[model samples]
Target: MENFDAIVIGSGQGGNPLAKKMAEKGWKIALVEQRQPGGTCINDGCTPTKTMIASARIAHLLSRSDTWGIRNQGYTVDLPAIIARKNEVVQQFRNGTVKNLEKAGVTVLMGTAVFSGVKTLTVTMHDGSIRELTATHIFINTGAAPFIPEIPGLRDVPYLTSTSLQEEVKVPPELIILGGGYIALEMGQLYRRLGSTVTIVEKSAQLMSKEDPDVAAVIKKILEAEDIEVYTATTTEKISGTQDHIEVQLQTAGKSHIITGTHLLVATGRNPQTAALQLSKTNVTLDEKGYVQVNDQLETSCPGIYAIGDVKPGPAFTHISYNDHLILYKNLFEEAELSTKTRQLPYCMFTDPQLGRIGLSETSARQAGYPVKVAHLSMDKVARAIETGETAGFMKAVVHEHTGQILGAAVIGTEGGEIMSVLQMAMLGGITATQLRDMIFAHPLYAESLNNLFMTLEK
Candidate 1:
């Protein structure tokens, strides 16, 4: 039996930083990771996917090079090369994570951890050894995994997931994605650009169902413009096929439809990684959906134990996971009063015209009884978008009608995330719509659209 000041089960964004910081502060910390040390964001999620997306984006741009007045014969996408580069990037991140923990003197345990009792754990090591550990404090940041929905014959057929797809060396000639969320859209666009005929089947009425109907509609239009087929309000009844030749039976509006593709990707969603933890042995509570129940301070019902990042309920962005560590660390070590509440939620969907959002949506604001005036501008209105010839989205903000406060905003265009961050800073500083409307920014930049955007609310 080994005892430590803290035992972090999962070296995710939150857990790793906390473990390192705790160890540096002279607290004995043991960080257990079942797979790669860097967790999902580094090993599979953001790092690998975005690295491949960069390659895909270049392919897309070159395909439409004529519009940009660039003369080129043609170029072919090398799937193996793209996968190799992505693997290199992922490995780089993994190496850094391991180095950081080692330098901080954290005991990095390569094993799967399960609870034995309150503040106690039994780990099954990768080398087939058992290790018992108990800690004064325990943090669970196991993160999430790609969810595979249950459908008839799904298990019998070889299907790809968000993670497995990234490992594939060959691009599917025809790809069918069985979800319409951000992950599905990203992977769909990636494969489509890599020379695959991509089809997205969304059970909801629209893609990105959480976004406003108009937002989702515009996104669907963008994808369709790229020759990607989208099927909404469609139920996938069953799946049947072998690798490189997959078949799916779908039902839509009470009509049966069948589709076949070279590959099938199930990108429904991700559930918290709590199933492996024997929480039943402790007082920690979980929601009906299996997410760890934590307070604003990230404390579980079980004393001295906490859950952070995607393991707990709420938004599951990498930034959110990283910020969880800040909140927990400040509260525990620095005696700083902090919490998850009242923290602005910002997220970006990495489509070609990225969907960057923060705070409430116009739809959500109105539903919440906020009297809001909306500012809207099409991407064509922005000089930069016009010059780049990539004008395909909009910039929108919701402002308090009376106070002129920016309530929420969404940017869906080229470099949308960067543009949205400018607005986020404005919101953080409590800058009103009137002030932003007159602010002078460098001309012909996407951010200059903010002036024109906020100007709409006044008119």
Candidate 2:
């Protein structure tokens, strides 16, 4: 039997940080994880995905070397090498996380932890040994799993989820992807750049349906130009496979079509990882969608138990999970009141011409009864964009017409993710448009577009 002041389940983004903070506060902390210490984002999700994207971007730039007067012969993508490098990166980070947790004086438990009773957990270790743990406070940050949707014949056919596909060292000749979100777009582009004939089927009206329609359309244009076929407002009717190929039946515009590919990757969204936690033993409540229900302070129905990250209902980004750690830290140790609503969160999509947005959209602002004014500037018009020979997107800013306060900003271009932080900070700090316009920004940079964007807004 082991006792601790706090027991954190799952040593991912949320659990690792929470355990470290509590241990630093002179509390005995037990960090429980069934798999690798770094969790999904470090292993199969963000790190691997971004490394693959970087490789894809290099391949893309090499293919476009003609524009720079460099007559490059044909290039080949060593898919196996790329996959090996990605795995190397994931392993390095995962090992680093394990070391950091140990240095923090956290007692790491490797096992499947289940609820034995209120504030009690029976951790079943890998060797079939059992250990009981009791804690005064418990944090559940089990994260989420990829959602595999049920399509007729999908179960029998061989298909890859996001996690499974990361293990592939060779690129398929023809790839068919279902679900048109960020993951699908990114992986589709990566494989397409590596010489795969990729096709994307999106059930929504457009790819990246969560973003503004205009932003999604611009991304679709860029993707089509890359020779990747995209079918929007489509449904995957069925799937069938053989040793060499897989056939996907898709329905779009009330018309049925079959597409054949050597590989099938499903980029559907995720669901909370709560099924194994056995929440019925505790007072914790879950919504219909299976996410643990929590108050604005991230507290579950049970006292002294909190949930964060994908297990709770909110955006499921790595940064958002880190922010949750901050909120939970304040509530637990700093004696400060914290809530999810108190933070200004932002989201980014890492595609060619990445898309990033913060706060309310223009449509949302208008619907919320704010008289909104929108200012947009094309990347082509920015001087630095012209100098860089990569000017194929735009920046849009939405503001309240009466107060000139920034309601939201969306950037889709080179360094869109970097430029978004300035706008995000402005919105979070309540900085008005006039303040942004008056501030002197560095010359001849991608971020200079912000000066032009805010200038267009009529004050």
Q: Could you estimate the TM-score for every candidate?
A: 0.99, 0.98
Model 1 Cα displacement at 56 (Å)? 0.4
lDDT of 2 by residue, 1-459 (tens): 688999999988878888888888899999889988887889878999999999999999999988877888778898888998998998899888888888889999899999988899999998889999999899998999888998998888889888888787778889899999988998899889888899999999988887788888899998999999999999999999975589999888999989999999988889999998898999999999899999998889999888878898988898888888899898778888887886887878888878888888877777899998898988889898788788888899888888889988888888888898989988878888878877788897777667788888854
> Residue 316 lDDT in model 1?
91
Native-referenced Cα lDDT, model 2: 0.88
What is candidate 1's TM-score against the reference? Answer: 0.99
- Tens-digit per-residue lDDT, 1-459, candidate 1: 899999999999999999999998999999999999888899889999999999999999999999988999999889999998998989889999999999999999999999999989999999999999999999999999988888999989989899998888888889999999999999999899999999999999999888888889999999999999999999999899887889899999999989999898999999888998989999999999899999999999998999988989999988999999999889988999898898989899999989999889989999999998899999988999999899999999989999988888889999999998998988999998889999999988899889899877756
Candidate 1 residue pairs in clash (backbone atoms < 3 Å): none
User: Where is model 1 more than 4 Å wrong at Cα?
Assistant: none
Show model 2 residue runs off by greater than 4 Å.
none
Error of 2 at 102 (Å): 0.9
lDDT over C-alpha atoms for residue 124 of model 1: 99
